[model samples]
Target: MSEPLVSIRSANLFTPNGTRIWKDLNWDLFPSEIHALIGESGSGKTTLAYSLFGLLGESWKYDFLHWDVLGYDLSYWSGPFGEELRGRSIFLVPQNPNLAFHPYRKIKDQVIDFFRLGLRSSEDPKEILELWKEMGITRPEEKWNSYANGLSGGEKQRICLSLALLGDYRILVLDEPTTGLDANTEKWVLRAIRKKSEEGKLGVIFISHDLRIVESMASRITIMKEGSAIESFPVKDRKIEPTTEYGKELEKARRFFL
Candidate 1:
């Protein structure tokens, strides 16, 4: 069998104040799979996405954060190793793109910086310009040179996603890519993500509260609650049954929460 693209094992997380949250938490992302990580607000779904890149918040701790990606060990990577890992191995698109870029810098410069950090090949300005057009940003040249303040929320999100795709990463983690997008943009973004996953280039771990979207996109489903993975199953299975009450409710009322 092929190895999983990434794995997290023996993780026991706790709040920074010394409150235990989960014990022996584990999960895997197989190649080319779209794994949906779903839960209500404050269930730690975004934290789990952050943990994959060792971006532990001030209020979090872990007994062990053992992780591996594409045959490279990142369990204890720090300093330069941590920088390289984040810049190349795994990519994360935050729900809020406002914090990702410097307000004072041009978007073009920021994207070039990302190219330098995450890529090893020679940079071609046209490549990013192409990405700009592909990401649905009209007038690529103008948008490319504009700073964050000049872009709309959906535009910023698309630009951020475009940046994420430029990296030669094995896994991509998305935290609610459709947060503020209009229906058309949302559909386009999701279609782009699904197309990428289907191309078998990398695995994607998508964190979202939208079960309807998850139902259509995910090859496997994982429901998390209170910092633990309460349930998980292959989406292709003939029957999916969750043992937790929360899961049952979520399954039954996919639209109510959204």
Candidate 2:
């Protein structure tokens, strides 16, 4: 069996006020697999994503017995190694796509700067255009020169994903990628993500409350509730049958709407 891209055991996260929010969470992600984190709002799914890269800053506290990602020990994730990990090994797509860009900066300039500064590689304009095309962006040349504010939410989301792909990342953490998108837009966005994951270049950590999307995209699933990963299983033949009560309840809720 291949080694997991990410692994955690006996992990806990506390709020700034020292209130325990996440407890005894254990999870694993493998390369070329889409592992979905499904739960309700305030379930600490987003916090788990943020904590992976130490984005919570020094205020929040984490107690992890074993935390490893991309072959590095992230038990103390706020140090120099953590700085090296962000945008390099793991790229997080925020719930709000607007947070990924500056409204005033041209998309073309920002992309070029990223390749130059972040990767230290000479970026080909054609490569950028091609990447956007793969993300379902129409008329990449025209949109390239446009400001972030000019793009629609779906477009910005795709743009953020394209930028992340350009980085040297092994894992992509998306917090609700299809949220607020029209049905058609959501379809293409999901298609693009699926295509990328199927390419087997990296692993994806897809965090969403939408079980339908999770069932459609993820090869493995982890059910989280009240800050704990209560159950984890492979999505055999695209079917999810949870063994835990909370997980069964979530599946029941999903089926009720269907």
In the range 12-85, model 1's lDDT, one tens digit per residue, is: 87877887666677888887888889877887788777766667754566676666756656444433567676
> What TM-scores do the predictions have?
0.88, 0.88
Instruction: In model 2, state the lDDT of residue 3.
Output: 97
Cα lDDT of model 2 by residue, 1-258, tens digit: 689988999998898999898898898989888999987777888888778777888888888899888777764467876776564567777899988888888998987876765543578889879877866789999999999988988888887777655666678899888765667767766777777776846789999877888888888988878899988899987788899988888998985432
**Candidate 2 TM-score to native:** 0.88
Candidate 2 clashes between residue pairs 3 or more apart in a chain or in different chains: none
Q: Which stretches of candidate 2 lie over 4 Å from their true place?
A: 118-122, 130-139, 165-167, 180-185, 255-258
The TM-score that candidate 1 achieves is 0.88
Instruction: Score each candidate by Cα lDDT.
Output: 0.77, 0.81
Off by over 4 Å in 1: 57-59, 65-67, 70-75, 237-243
